[model samples]
Target: MTRYKIGVVGCGFFGSSLARELAAHPRFELAMLCDRDFERAKDVAAEFSATPTDDHDAVAADPELALVVVATPNHAHAEPAIAALEHGKAVFVEKPLAVELVDAQNMIASADASGSPLMVGHIMRMMPGVRRLADLLASGELGEVAAIETSRSRWIDTDGADPQWWKLDKSRTGGELTHEIHELDLMCWLGGEVTAVSSIATADDGFRNTVVSFAGGAIGRHTISTRSHTSSWELTVDAAEGSVHADFHTGRVSRLRGGRVEESWPIFDVDAENQSLIDSASRTQKYNSGNGGSSLWMQAAIRHEIDEMAAVLDGKADSGSPLTYARERALVVAEQVRLGGGEPAALSGSAK
Candidate 1:
């Protein structure tokens, strides 16, 4: 088995967790850990027996690093990812692609130019329950997917691993839409390409809702809330023949056809635990409000993603690569979000 050398930028919660997981995985060699905080990088690097540095450029320059995984903050994903690709390394970055459309496009362009395998980290699409849901839809069991509704909430605390300020600050993080873009990607993944989006966001109150119109006349409605102490996540899809309900955090997926329960399954191997939709760095990606954490299933999904990417890089066929799929759709969603649903013209891909 070929073990890919990996460099992870950002020593924050998600980054550290991914670095740890990569180090333990048999297919990966945790080569470098980079963050602005050299001390934090050192601590995490020590755990994995990997090199630690405060300089991101060092990782990009490392000839031994075959992969670069960018788990930086919502606004900071672009630079490391783009630079890594330019350096001839396969790159994976956690979602929202980038806070700005131009940056996202540049990242996509870089990947295209570099001829390196690029995949947007829309982790939920790989969830077991979501994978089953995708299976049902593809098999025509759910019939034609007409509409999808998804809702999620995570109560964030200022003292939490991720401070409240960074989560809510629209100026730095692109506000609530940063989170919603993931949902938007699911919409496109399940419902099809998002032809247009009619959305609204309240940064101060921390609420957002969007009515998306798919290319083929399908419809999708999504709600993302980072406020409130109660954390919950559920996505219900209605089709012509049946409907499917998915609990992202707990991994519960069910199907109802003709007013009867046709089938149901857990995203994880066991129904013994519940999962939430929100994977917060605050809880170290745990959904304690529901499941213990983001569930070991998510870790499996990441592993699968890494393995597939490694194969693709090694001349294997890769399908359904959302290299720019999620990012492009996310750019449209981000534009609408930053505009506060201002005008129909704001729906255009251009960002202010």
Candidate 2:
């Protein structure tokens, strides 16, 4: 068995976590850690026994590295990812792809030009529970998807985040909608391509509600908030045959007809999932600060995506293309940011 050599740019919370996972996996060798902050890179590199550097260009130019994981701040994603892609290195960028439309387009274009695989990290879609729901919809077990909705809301513990925290900068994070794009991307993936969307958002854009029209004639409602006292992450789908719901808060997905559940599946392992939630609540009832200590369920999702990336490298599975699902999600977010407080707007491209 040959291990693909990989390196991670941006040695922050998510990037370091990814490095740790890749190091532990047998199919990949974590070779380098890069960050603008040398100390951050050094610390993470020490843990993983990988070289540490502050130069992304060096990482991109290294011939030995087959993959470059871009876990930089949302606004900074394009530069490193585009560099790696242009160098013919497989690149995996964390979600939201990019905060702006132009940057996203540039990243996609570079990937196409270089013929290197580019994958965005949308871990929600990789979860076993979400996969089960997607399978049901694809098989028409729930009939045609008439409507799909997702709600993700939780309070942050800060009035305003630390000045150094990029998430507090709307220009960088694209507010809550783009920052919490997992649900937005999930709706499009599980439902279908969006034709148009109408949204309402708060002044600060910390809360947003959007209605999406799908090319398949299905509709979707997405609601996200960062100001809720109670925290929940759930999705519900309505179809001609019946309805289904998934509650990540409780790690359960159920199929229903006539208001009764016909089948139920654990989102992950039931005991571990429940324990993770308990531990999470005991630590902080508020939203995760991305300072580490993510739930076991989330860790599992990351591992699953890592496996997918490896499979793509081994030619066993197709790369998770940014041109399709990721672009679709980014388009919806762009429209949400544009027409968020105005009249309904059609998606920029032709309907699916």
lDDT (0 to 1) per candidate: 0.70, 0.77
Candidate 2 lDDT by residue in tens digits, 120-202: 88887777777777878878767788888898887766644476677767788877778778887888777655667778778
| Local distance difference test, candidate 1 | 0.70
Cα TM-score of candidate 2: 0.90
Give, for candidate 2, the lowest lDDT window spanning 10 residues.
343-352
How close to the true structure is residue 28 of candidate 1, measured as C-alpha lDDT?
86
Which runs in model 2 stand beyond 4 Å of their true positions? 159-161, 277-290, 319-324, 327-331, 340-352
**Model 1 alpha-carbon drift over 4 Å, by segment:** 159-165, 201-203, 228-232, 271-301, 314-317, 322-325, 340-352
What are the per-residue Cα lDDT tens digits for candidate 1 across 112-183? Answer: 788876667787676666777877887986677889987777765444333444544565567666655666
Per-model TM-score on C-alpha atoms? 0.83, 0.90
